[model samples]
Target: MAESANPIPRKAAPVRTKIDHLRLDVVGPVATLTLNRPERHNALSLDMYHQIPEMLSRLEIDRTVSSLVIRGCGLRAFSAGADITEFTTVRAGAEGARLYNLAVAEAERAISNFHAPTIAMVHGFCIGGGCGLALSCDLRLADTAAAFGITPARLGFAYSLESTKRLMDLAGPAEASYLLFSGRRVSAERALWNGLVNEVHPPEELEKVTYELAVEISKRAPMSLRATKEIIGLVRAGQVRDDDYTTALRNDLFESSDYIEGVEAFLGKRPPHFSGC
Candidate 1:
């Protein structure tokens, strides 16, 4: 047979998510959300962005969960960023891009506003929107050889204001501007020095160091940690108002069962069993 001169075009199959691009598993009092796309360096699709906030919301009210950790499954990357190939189709123009950016912003806010302390356990490449994800967390811990960058400029795209503001809050103007302008990957040491990551450990020690931090945070009084996280965000925004919510947050901690346990434990010279009340 000569075969056809031209092949007929067929519709692409819709992406399957029965097996989630994101996975949530609760280990003891800690909830770990793993980005499950290592084949593409855990690149995030629109669906993964949407799923993150949902998982965060679920964990926010689960009293049993004392903390949350976000990471990629394999060694190559925490996440390479948004799936850029999606751009050619569903994300082709300004409107599509606007909607996509909105989803990304919402996911970031969810992480930043999460009720429990959250950690970004980064390894390998954490770039573009990946950096946004890490910045959204309460803390970022990176492998010593990990690479970090935020490169909207490389794509001829302006950085989103909310993401830029968060990055600025973490690294200050000079460091943020340097990263944004050059769009170059910085090593773990440079990332630590620039305040882009809280700590950097050798690849062999990355998990040990990150989870140790998570464990220490989990052992603290949960209510106090949650309130502190909330207040610090306000402080960063130059907020000083003692409004109703602020006043309540300040007062209610004293009334919590954890408060009583903390005090009793201090006096008794024993570990406290906080109920997170």
Candidate 2:
């Protein structure tokens, strides 16, 4: 009777290897991205450059994701800049430079216009293209160990006008010019003083503090945050001359669910639990 039937062996579950250069993880309403090429100090390869736009697109459409946090893996650096190896080939001539510049422009636009609030949780080196990524974020929280520079001058390359303007917006004309001219790394304190970063935390506390700040931001009204970001963009572009959309957004917020919850919670002496509706 025991030999009458044979049991079938079960197949093993698949094991997932970490992506070699980029890591994406979700915690509650926050999506965290890590540059994973630690052996090369997280140098930005062409593949890494392309993967960023796709990742940002994914995060943008995920309604559950209210905010994002970006940092480097292994704590050595956020990104040491573009992979110089690839640059040798990609920057070889005018045609090559044109294609490479187009790719960079697409990446920059994707990061800057992503729907959710984004935070750059920077540590160690954030230079060149890395600074471009960090500047695209709505907020930047750097560790005391962090350093920043835009090194196109040293490389005999001219930065895109949009990238230069973004840096100027964060650091002002004088500091932006100094860094661009010298190609010198600025200290975290200097970056903070120049408004390049929203806050500077100790190295050990950077991850924890950045996560806390992301959660705080995620708990706010989504519509208000999105509208504010859009309005800021219009203002920056010199396109916000008494627009009806901007006025409507301001009026609509008064009647939002978040506003109702906010008032009730205040009266009850409790924290508002916004659903982001």
Candidate 3:
């Protein structure tokens, strides 16, 4: 069989980190952030929620990382959602609930605002806050066996407005209402149809597919990626017209060295090496 014109780049040795219930692994330009409590279906503990923003901050400074994949440590789940075990104590009073909710929002915001593209590699159960985290990513690739749900209605808790908006944007208001009202688990195929997931793969092939996408994205001009991400965000925020900031952003890309390399490489029919300048 003829190989692809742009072959998948060979992966580099992963630099691993042990940060309690979460794991961070970087291989080449791709970083994998794993929810590591597999024994509890990769539930997000209170401390784990607190760690997310800090973890993302560390990655933001590493220019070498062009993309990130957020997943679970095991095949059983992407995340079953926030640890209910802590709800009684950590979310006990009005003050506790306020702080806990703030932590969740901040963590999701960090992921949503990450400079690089973020992919959520999901499998098994993605429920409640787990679904929120996945929705926060730029894209979601799921295993065929994966199931997704948001269950705040069942818990008698109000879902955050940010999370609800994200869901509404991806799956539309009708589908979002159904999920929110029923608290039913939708299969991977159904989720795909509803636009909840970008793609669905067999369990055995999920990792391969997700990482290949990450590598392909990493190969693009970094400035372009960042600019596009921000531009789309602006559009989402109802800024359709080009403002001073957008004009400056556009001007910078044109003046960048990567733009020159990209043009030259295109004319030469070769891959361009982007310096992210």
Candidate 4:
């Protein structure tokens, strides 16, 4: 049999687009969202905060995406936290602070509810609002050079119930209290020990290692992964009984295509190729 040769030409690469304080790049099934204000230690400005929810919405609906990585543009910071300079003018009084806090609450909600699994690759200063952002993600990976802190105490601002609870879920009540009350920077090793970070790598290996983790996650079944995330959120919110959902999901996984592939590959002594079905 002779193979037919076609003359259809390949299309040009899509134009790479970038927003003012954020950059989205997709390679294969993994998407990386970078906070782009490196000159300011990637501080979360009002504009950047507003842009996040919108960007996350787009990623959630994009079928091509299988995993997400949130990171800072430079090694100096994942974020230095909310831009305090803007707070001076934007949060001038009690009423203004109330409104600002409400907006922040909405942004945090969006991150916490993102459809796919998310990883925060933290380095340098991840403080105040940055900590809230990282804690919202499904997993957090920090570099050896990273520092973690929640600075509500230092700024004389009260932390929201949701943000406080998220931190407590990661580090337990006692550790969360220490960080929130003192506003002290903790080393990456301490953050890991306290359960704030799932993994810590050398500074030079951070980005590469983060991408590899994302790739591994992308190989899992999409439905099962998303269901697991949803169940975790339900448990965290105290809206559901853990045993009920846990057992149902475990049974559901047995019928999944990825699970079949995983088992077969194990028996066959080969690597499994999962389509995330």
CA-lDDT, candidates in order: 0.83, 0.81, 0.91, 0.82
**Predicted candidate 4 versus true structure: per-residue lDDT over 1-277, tens digit per residue:** 1111111111323223378988876666777778889889988877777778887788777766678888887778999999899888887799878877877787788878887889999978898888888998889999998999899999888899999999999999999999988999999999999999999998877777887788888777777777888888878888755586578877887888888998899899988787666
How do these models rank on lDDT, best leading? 3, 1, 4, 2
> Any idea what lDDT model 1 has?
0.83
lDDT of 2: 0.81
TM-score of 1: 0.91
Compute each candidate's TM-score over C-alphas: 0.91, 0.89, 0.95, 0.87
Off by over 4 Å in 3: 1-11
Off by over 4 Å in 1: 1-19, 241-244
Using lDDT as the measure, the top candidate is: 3
Winning candidate number (TM-score) = 3
- Across 1-277, the per-residue lDDT of candidate 3 in tens digits comes to 2212222354566677768899887878988888989899999988998999998888898989999999987788999999999999999999999999999999999999999999999979999999999999999999999999999999999889899999999999999999999999999999999999999998878887888999999999999999999998888777979989999999999999999999999999999999999
Per-model tally of clashing residue pairs? 0, 0, 0, 0
Distance from true location, Cα of 203 in model 3, Å: 0.6
Looking at model 4, report the run of 10 residues with the lowest lDDT sum: 1-10
> Model 2, 60: alpha-carbon shift in Å?
1.8
